[model samples]
Target: MMVPCALHALWRTLLPVSCFINSVLAAYDEPQGRVATAMTLDPTPGKDAGPALPEAFVSYAFEFSSFPDFAGNSTSGPNLFSDQLLNNIGNITGTKPYIRAGGNTQDYAVYDPSLPVALVGVIDPERQPNYPTNVTVGPSFFESYATWPGARYVHGFNLARSNGTYGDEDLLGPVEPACRALGIDDRLLYWEVGNEVDVYNRGRFAVRPPGWDEADYVAEWLNATRRVRARMGEACPELATDERFKLWAPSYGGTDNGLDAVRPWQDGIDADGNVVEVSMHFYMSGYGLPGITLQGTLLNHTNTAARLAPHLNVSRALAAAAPGVPYALTEVNSLYNAGQPDVSNVFGAALWTLDFNLWCAANGVARVHMQQGLNFRYASWQPRDTGLAPKGTRPPYYGDVAVASAVGDLTRAEVRVRSLRMESETDAASVPSGRGEPLP
Candidate 1:
């Protein structure tokens, strides 16, 4: 029988390597700024219990900097994994979450098979010097996956190889070592072909021409995935016939203007059997846009749900087009472009995360991979101390902890969201009574 690829992929990301104690979870109440009039959940009598929520529902989103900063580099001081932290994560989630090593930096990464050093300088320090990018990584970079016991890995490869900077051959070099470090087909998840390749034309990487569309992406993706599959077989015998050893591709960003779910359906990536997931990225709002504010962008649930509805609608169509294929938000957070400092890093961000993730499950999204990074303004856990700030949990991590507890054990039962209702009342002048007039 074929493994439930979508659910499996989503499950891997559901557990992340951060801890929010029970006390913290209790402390985080749904923010008072917005309150539902009344909500109810009534399980349907004959509905399939649906997929169970994994032990956790949030996973890590590491930037390319993680290679030297969090993964390898024992010589560079302390790594993100400590016995106490790992234990805390496990205790909170009840299972180890998968780690996704990719972000904007993943697109700029090149593989160096025989480099003498563990890492080469990637990002320009003077120009936002600390940001992770513009570098090549060696095999030692993958060795760090071993540090987290039972923790699976979803490794991203450079897909912007169109300029002859690298080829499918160069891209496949990391697979063998990654497989070895991950116990040779044991803990490795799917290889993401690209990071939001849909927006490549205007994106930071600008890897493709402005005229590029899903057709261009599909053709290149097919070729790359085929090569990666063949290499996986040669590197690990177990993967030769295992369907679970899959590729996730055509990761689209949160805009409906470009290719929609039908693109992957037409490309056959969704139902190919070996392809595990059709993933995308989502954010509540664009950073630095006019009128963008903390209350309006990340804190407002009504605004967020409306913004997310289009993507969810696309996912629903994709599920029908390729029956049994899982749809996932492989990368998601409150805001795009790293996020706004005080807003994305605060308690309200946690509330946003919890509400949004639950909404995904209720709406049939197989998995929601909550994205994070070291010192990123929107990160849930800060891996290293910079200046006066010491490394520790950020406010949004409590959302993850709350999700982990809410999900509990997926193996035993499922968290089935039955229904949602909204009833509005009005008085004289049509303003809500609580605020002195009836609500509109």
Candidate 2:
């Protein structure tokens, strides 16, 4: 069955990034039906009225890792807390979003205050361009968050050791300062353990012996959470008791990532009331895959929706199981591995991102941290002074703007997908306004 999407009337503010105006112009050949019309209303109303959209629907966040800083590839770069970035986010969403400090690098990171800067000795720089195996950075690295306006930080700590023992040093250097930063601003979102634990047994980044299961992960996670909590209680007593101060656990990756989410929650991983939300990662496709192309990965709604069905299904069940606890895609984007060059950084990504977020909102995802890194092709904005891409907003950013604007004014909104066609590419001078109307 072909599922119809009715996203009419909700995209009034879906603005394309100016840099991507060319792609937008190219999508339409000439004037067809209603030109340049904002989706105003649903032509076919549902049998029963839907509920109002939740505030979380419009919420957007960014994810960065400790590894990037050591390699000088920090997503924030010298503009650690960019007013331009924050203002742009705020303008679109009507709310300031949090920045998640976690990723593959988070698990590889260690809190060694002794080091002046981070040490990146694990991965050979020549071989691993995007991936860093080992890195270390000092606590002050988090001070950048202070510059970010109304910033809430979701920090991640290293949980597993090199020997596969579920332990790492109780490095409170980064956490303490972040807590202090939070004490001043009162905006620490949650402390997450490790990056993606499901892949630990595969013997990759943070190698572990074969047969690492949920029981092992839960035991180690609880220990790490308590250790951090104790330090937090001493360093920032206010945050220790603050209800908002919480833990997000079992961040897992892989196709079976959903199953990994289930085990920890079912086993009462966060029964101590410290865990506030269940978190996981999602990427529509990975870089260097055999058949991935822009049209297949970003344009086709059927493929995108099908790929996400498994994750969404698990998320729905997890929501039902936990009742009030929300499930979040702590790390998500169109393509993983720093994304594909033109494909992920184009106007099609803007469309894909808009559709992707609405799908998550409809399926009960509370928040999405679109992961970005230095000079990544799929980054919403270039964070560093890179020669590869211009250091400004990219096409995917427009999608963020559109999603935020889509949910900005409404106390309630519903998103549904419907079939719509775009005209072909033509010269810029004679291009049409590119309007869309509901199909009757």
Candidate 3:
């Protein structure tokens, strides 16, 4: 049994030198297969084999302009755009909020000396001339916010037809100047080149009227974006990563925005373009607005989710054009028809809002704009206070708070979901807006 030399011939033969080495190698390759202990694991612990968004997802809502520009005026008489309003804004809305100053005002391109002033319904070319230039970010430039609870900015690009769509009044000039004047340039988040162009225009520049084919639309948007970027340089920078400026849209329905305006802005690229958002809009359900419940808010929301699914893939359609820009539901809420009881101000709305947000996050959307004008304005979402002030913290608020919390746990969570089911019933007492039971 005790072999003196290195190994006796018979012992060596039985040992099979390579056998021991092979066993060691096999054990080293997949330690888990043989391990009986509970804790032994692979050394790599920090890497993920899944999708992920950044740590925090910022929130964006809007307040329209109610300021009057009287040259010698002392804006002291309960100005629609007041300090109290800004103060209240910080209260109702969350921190890092964005304001789209251009939506209702439009009038980009040619700076008009005469256009209707915000909230006053009076035209004054001398005061609020160009759509983009009319609204100021306030004197303190929302710097007043460091003292307040939370406030941020995301300026809207003027798409109003009062000025020609392709005019060159701005190389992003007016907005940059206003923000710089207010010292809010550093806080500025995004610059929407246009809004709801899909449904708004037949083609080309929606206002220009010659109209746009798919190719022309993409080319024009790219050109406009490139021009704006040329002006922004290293000073401000693109929001390619930051939560606020994720570009949000042609903003059509799942179909073209009614006038066959699909895939245009998303179809072309600029020579010097850095698109980070592909935007869209939706407001599908309500009892009397479209005059179709389809089912109820619950069924409506489920259908809306299905309806929005194909549209969310605009990022894919944009793959060749903008390459890296992601998707965003930039301007959205429950109903396009504000007067509707079931969808506009109902409990069902809360459920619908919550579901839509979950759907977007679940489906890989990068950002969303709840489209609020809570305070008074031409198109205030709720219209309680002046558009300058913030309001609406119930159902929309529920969506806001709940979605933020839900999305927090899912920093790019790609949970394997089987299917979503919902049942909506209009029984007349389920909510104050006079709808019925909602199933989710």
Best by TM-score: 1
Write model 2 residue lDDT over 258-367, tens digit each, in one string. 23667777777876777787777889888888888776566655566677787777777777667687777788888887888778888778877776765565455677
Candidate 3 deviant stretches above 4 angstroms: 1-58, 63-104, 107-150, 160-167, 170-173, 181-185, 202-206, 226-254, 258-267, 285-288, 298-301, 319-323, 374-392, 409-440
Candidate 3: residue 129 Cα off by (Å): 22
Cα-based lDDT for every prediction:
0.61, 0.61, 0.41
In model 2, which runs have C-alpha deviations exceeding 4 angstroms? 1-81, 117-127, 162-173, 254-259, 387-390, 410-440
Q: What tens-digit string does per-residue lDDT give for candidate 3 at 11-54?
A: 12112111122133223334355552221222221222112332
- Overall local distance difference test of candidate 3: 0.41
Error of 1 at 257 (Å): 5.3
RMSD of each: 7.3, 6.2, 17.4
* Model 1 agreement with the true structure over 1-440: per-residue lDDT tens digits: 00011122232322211112211332234245654343232333124333555444556666765545555444454365533454465575566666778777677677788876656755576544446567677777776676565667788877776335565555787778766666554677777877777777874546677887777777777777667767878886576465656777667776574666567668666444677776778888755668776555654445555677887677777777766767778888887767777778887677667666765665667677777665677777776677735678788777777665555555544444322222332111111111222112
Error of 3 at 34 (Å): 48
Task: Name every residue pair that clashes in candidate 2.
Answer: 5-417, 5-418, 6-416, 6-417, 6-418, 9-39, 36-435, 53-412, 53-413, 118-136
Rank by TM-score (best first): 1, 2, 3
